[model samples]
Target: MTSMMAPNAAGLSDADIANLAAHIASFGGAAAAPAAEAPAAEAAAAPAAAAGDVAAGKAKFAACAACHGMNGEGQGMFPKVAGQSADVLADKLKKYRAGETVGPMSAMMAPNASGLSDADIADLSAYMASL
Candidate 1:
């Protein structure tokens, strides 16, 4: 089988993914278990939150508040940023900075993200995660 598929190509949720990982482990194919991705991805991101200062992020978030709302509840056409995973936030910001379009907000987000440094992105990610 291929190593990966769409998140729910098989109609599996996060819990389902874990169960599949367990089954893979039981089959003596631990090395091929897709569930191991959880830990590896987590390990890779472990330093991201530490690299940022929450206070600074809150200050940085002002630009985003116009659309996302102060509490990240989002408004009108904007999506909520609060409560998002730091990893997700960092990735999206990076993509936006690189001129990659994520969705309807891409045009708006790119300009906002363009001037952010890595540290700025980290701080925003950390603060968003804590929301």
Candidate 2:
């Protein structure tokens, strides 16, 4: 953090005060892009998940192994999904698939959920829940 002269402090030159003020102004103002663009970018990058089947979910989960771990233990920023409730998991996936939740990873999972039927969602939910 850069400090400026306290209202009445020392011998600062005019340029020094101007530079500091500029720096301070720069800190709060938007650089170029509007803040609204960020959410749009995230939405575009992420995929939306949706309802799926439990039995079919197992097969679907197979494709998720690379990042979620073989047993859904998860790694790094990836969350552990093995013991998650089916209802919750299904809901989250549905959000991702619908683009309601945007993120690069969510976007990736969205397409995977595209063709899933209701039974597939239930099965996957049950399988993941049981795990």
- TM-scores for every candidate against the unseen true structure: 0.63, 0.51
lDDT of 2 at 63: 50
* CA lDDT for candidate 1: 0.69
Candidate 2 residue runs with Cα over 4 Å from true position: 1-56, 102-104
Worst 10 residues of 1 by lDDT: 29-38
Candidate 1: tens digits of C-alpha lDDT, residues 1-131: 33223422355467756755554344342222111123656747575556888898997776676557778777666788889888788878877877789987788677567767678889989998889
lDDT of 2 by residue, 18-106 (tens): 75455435334432221122375664453222344456667667655544666888865566889887767665665554555555567
The list of candidate 1 runs beyond 4 A from truth reads 1-47
Clashes of each: 0, 24
